[model samples]
Structures are given as structure tokens and as C-alpha cells.
Target: DRSARLPPYGKKRLKTCSFTFRNALLNIKEELQKAISTMTARATHSADVAANTSKNVAEKLDLALAIDKRISKLASQAIDYSSQLSGFDSGLATQMASFQEQMSQIKRELKEGLGRLEHVTANAESAGWYFNDCTC
Candidate 1:
């Protein structure tokens, strides 16, 4: 009777081990899939942020260019008026002075904006490096 029971005991042990192994493998698979999903989502978010940042940079550059054009036109006008006036055109001179002040303000704002953009770009690059380091 003992000999007959031995076979059944060994078979039961084998079944338990196989079941445990299968469960372990399934758990590992699920964990891997979850990790992959999380990474994909993070990558997508990063790409979106990069794209939006690029768009914002383009817009800012356009604005800066427009400001430059306006400043150039105003300077040309001021130069022409100055040459035409011999101690004259006080009103035009005052207007040109105001325009010059406004242009200076715009230049300051553009510089600040470019500085901010550079800071943001640097941060993004650092973040990318961090992500790569973490992944490795």
C-alpha cells in the first residue's frame, strides 16, 4: 500500500511545482507589460511636450522678427525726418522718441522670452538625459 501511495504523492508534488512555476511566469509577464505600458505613456507625453515647445518657439521667433521689422521701419522714418529737419519737427521728434522707447521695451521682452525658452529647452534636454539614464 505504501508503494502505491508513493507514486501519487510524487505526482502531486510535481503538479504543485508546475502550477507554481506557471503562476510565477504569468506574474512576471504581467509586470513586464505594465512597465512597458507606463514607459510608452511617458514617452508619448514627452514627445507632445517637445512638439508644443517647438511650436511656441516658432511663434516667439515670428513675433521677434515682426518686432525687428517694425523697429527697422521706425528707425528709417526717424532718420529721414531728422535729415529733413534743421532744428525743426519737434512733434515728430517726440513721436520718434516714444517709438524708440516702445521698441526698447519690446526688445527687452523678446530677450526675456528667448531666455525663458532657452531655459525650458535646457530643462527638457536634462529630463531626456535623466530618462535615458533611468532606462539604462
Candidate 2:
């Protein structure tokens, strides 16, 4: 009703202004749609990249865990070998000590036997039974 009171020129100018305003609103809407589309595409790409990175990290983590397990197994084996070597060394030392004791005993017995042989030879010589004169 109030617009009906305007002069013809004013009405024409109002129509033109309304047209321009509508065009501006349409353009703004179009720009907003383009921005939304671009943002959605970027978001999708970021999500994909994140997923790939996560997968890579998981793989590396699995490999690290496997290596850790292997290292633990190797360490355990080393400990077992070290203990076995220690036991072997102890046994060898005991055996060596026993062998040395046996050698000492043998040497003492040999000396005693030599002394008895020397005494017997002296007694035989005093009786004039010469060993070098035996032909058999």
C-alpha cells in the first residue's frame, strides 16, 4: 500500500534496486555453495591422508613389537648358555684338581719304589751277584 503512493520514477527506481539486491543475494549464495564444495573436498582428502598415516604407524608398531620379542628370546638364550658355560668351567676345574692330586700321589709312590729298589740293589751287590754278568 505504501509503495502504491510512490511516484512512477520512484517505483521504477525501487524495482531496479530490488532486482540488483536479488542478484547480489543469488551471487552470494552461489559463492557460498562453491566454498562449501571446496571445503568438503579438502576435508575428504585430509581424512584419507590421516587414514593412510594411521595405517603406516600401525604397521611400524607391529614390526617393533616383533623385534622386541625376538630380542627378549635371544637374551634368554644367552643367559642359558652363560650358565651352562659356568657349570662346565666348574666341572673342568674340579677334574683338573683331581688329576693333579693323582699325579702327586703317583710321583710319591714312584720315589718310594725307587728308594726300595736302590736298597735291594745294594743288598744284591754286597752278595756279589753282578747284574751285567747275566747272559739270559
**TM-score, structure 1 vs. true:** 0.55
Q: All candidates' lDDT scores?
A: 0.92, 0.95
| Candidate 2 lDDT score at position 128 | 60
Flag regions of model 2 displaced more than 4 Å: 115-136
TM-score of 2: 0.73
Candidate 1, residues 31-132, lDDT tens digits: the string is 999999999999999999999999999999999999999999999999888777845677688889999999999999999999999999999999999998
Error of 2 at 12 (Å): 2.8
Q: Output the number of the TM-score-best candidate.
A: 2
Error of 2 at 47 (Å): 1.5
How well is each residue in 1-136 modelled by candidate 2, as lDDT tens digits?
A: 8679999898999999999999999999999999999999999999999999999999999999999999999999999999999999999999999999999999999999999999998988965655556665
Candidate 1 lDDT:
0.92
Per-candidate clash tally:
0, 0
Pick out the ten consecutive residues of candidate 1 with the lowest summed lDDT. 1-10
